[model samples]
Target: MPTPDLLTGELTLTGRITTASNATFLGTIGELVVVYKPRAGESPLWDFPSGTLAHREAAAYKVSEVFGWNIVPHTWLRDGPLGEGMVQAWQEEDPSQNPVDLVPAEAVPGSDWKQVLRGQGEDGQMVALVHEDSAALRRMAVFDVVVNNADRKGNHILAMTEGHRHGVDHGLTFHHEHKLRTVLWGWIGDALNADELEGIDRVREGLQGQLGQQLADLLSAEEVEALALRCDRLRSDGQFPAPSGQAPAVPWPLF
Candidate 1:
């Protein structure tokens, strides 16, 4: 399906994603599967303004596009069965691979994975939260930081069959305040490579032009300003940031 069709085609809701904090649906535009989150269905959040999560989701996609890394799936705002909402193309993740995972602490891969932390599992076994040390996931970590994503849980990172990684469920992002909670804290102080720095530079440049204009429409003026500041700070620091603030650095129920 073409972009126009996905934007204007009739949305048919197939089912509800009961696990989502806000009302989320699995739906279709003709033959193309998509995920929808209606504005009216958004639950009131203490920190975020009401009825704006959908807009934040779309804003995240715009920032992702500016980064020139396909960190987020294609997302946009459109009128749907319930009401106006955010819709994103559905991704069929590769089941054979686990990009972010919780494994027995002693069993964490010594080579390919970066362990974030160690904790006790429900079954009383010691487990470790870990994610891949690949370039794809690292890009996603940077993307999450740029967006100030407050809920980059394990399930939100999708591993594709061809090694691509897509981060989803971005409604909890772009807050004016520092709220960078995520499971991708493996590279806390690692220096960002040239390509990563280049991506940050692109975002900084975009904020001076079209990307800034687009975000102004989706986020509050303060939020947009904060987004630009984050890009600048990241570029200036030249390394992955250590988690800061009074709130938890990582989201609960990690998966």
Candidate 2:
């Protein structure tokens, strides 16, 4: 089958994703499946301006494209059945593979996974939050830092069948302030490798060209500047930063 044109196709709603905080819908454009979140359906957030969540989602995808890491799926803003919204190609993840997971505290894998923290489970058993230790996930962590992602829950990391990891639900990104809450703290304090530094350099360079102009349409001037500053800071430090804010380092409900 030919690939559907996401930009100009007619989006038809199939169903709602009720678990999402915003009014998200499962949709289709011809034979292509996608997820849609309308600007009108966005819930009010105190820190973020109302009705801009969809724009932020698109901005995240733009940055991901600059990195060439494929951290986020193809995302863009378009008019859907509900109205103007953010539409992204739906990714079918491997059910058996979990890049991020909660396992028994003692049973955490030593070599393959990096343990984030240990906490009590709902049943009062001790559990540890862990994620795969791999180059793909490390790139995602760097991407999250540069975007100032406020929420990077375990569920947001999709483990694809071919071992590629994709991140989703990036509405809480690119704030001017330092609101980088995430579960990918496994590489904290580790020096960024050459490839990671190259990716950051690409973003830094893009900010002075087309990427900066693209973000200007989706985010405020201050937010875009902050993104540039983040890229510069990460390149300067050459290491994964530790959480450094009064707010919680990780999001509530880690999963």
Candidate 3:
């Protein structure tokens, strides 16, 4: 069988992801599965301008690509059955491993995982949120920081086979003001690894070339400049940053 042409192949809506604030559809391009977020289906958000979420999603994919990290699955803007939207290749996550998990506080394991924080569950039981201490997740955390991702919920981190991690739902990103919220705060203040710092450097360089030109089509001038500033700041710090803005540190419904 030939590879499915995601752009031109017919899109069949498989299901609706109703939990999403905006209308999200599970779609298929021949045998290839994908998630489609149409611009027309997007709900209004006070912080972000309306009808631009799809472009933001595509911009996140471009950033991930420039960093040479397959953090976000292959995504692009296209005219789909629903309308013009961002379509991303679907990632079937490994059920056994989760990048972020909430375990009983007392039961938190000592090895392989880093404890993020402790909190009470709805049942009034103590729970400790933890994330795998691996290079994949650290890369994703860096990606989020650069994008200023404001809604990095736990479930958005997809643990794929062979330890690959993919981040999704990046519509709320690249705002001029600080708006970084995420569950991947376990590495705060940690020294940036050589590879991570190199990725940041590559992105900074790309911002002056094709990456910057492409982003100019998707984001505002101020937003693009802010992205460059984030890259500079992260490079200068040489470490994972602590939450600085007044915005909430994590998104609600921790997953």
Candidate 2, residue 34: the lDDT equals: 94
lDDT of each: 0.93, 0.94, 0.91
Clashing pairs in 3: none
The residue-by-residue lDDT of candidate 3 on 58-176, one tens digit each, is 99999999899889999988888879999999999999987789999999977888898899998999999998888998999999999999999999999888888999999999999
Worst 10 residues of 1 by lDDT: 1-10
Tens digit of lDDT per residue, candidate 1, span 147-188? 999999999999899999999999999999999999999999
- Give candidate 2 regions above 4 Å deviation: 1-4
Better of 1 and 3 by lDDT: 1
For model 2 the local lDDT of residue 68 reads 93
Task: List model 2 lDDT by residue over 197-254, tens digit each.
Answer: 9999999999999999999999999999999999999999999999997999999888
lDDT of 1: 0.93
Q: Show model 1 residue runs off by greater than 4 Å.
A: none
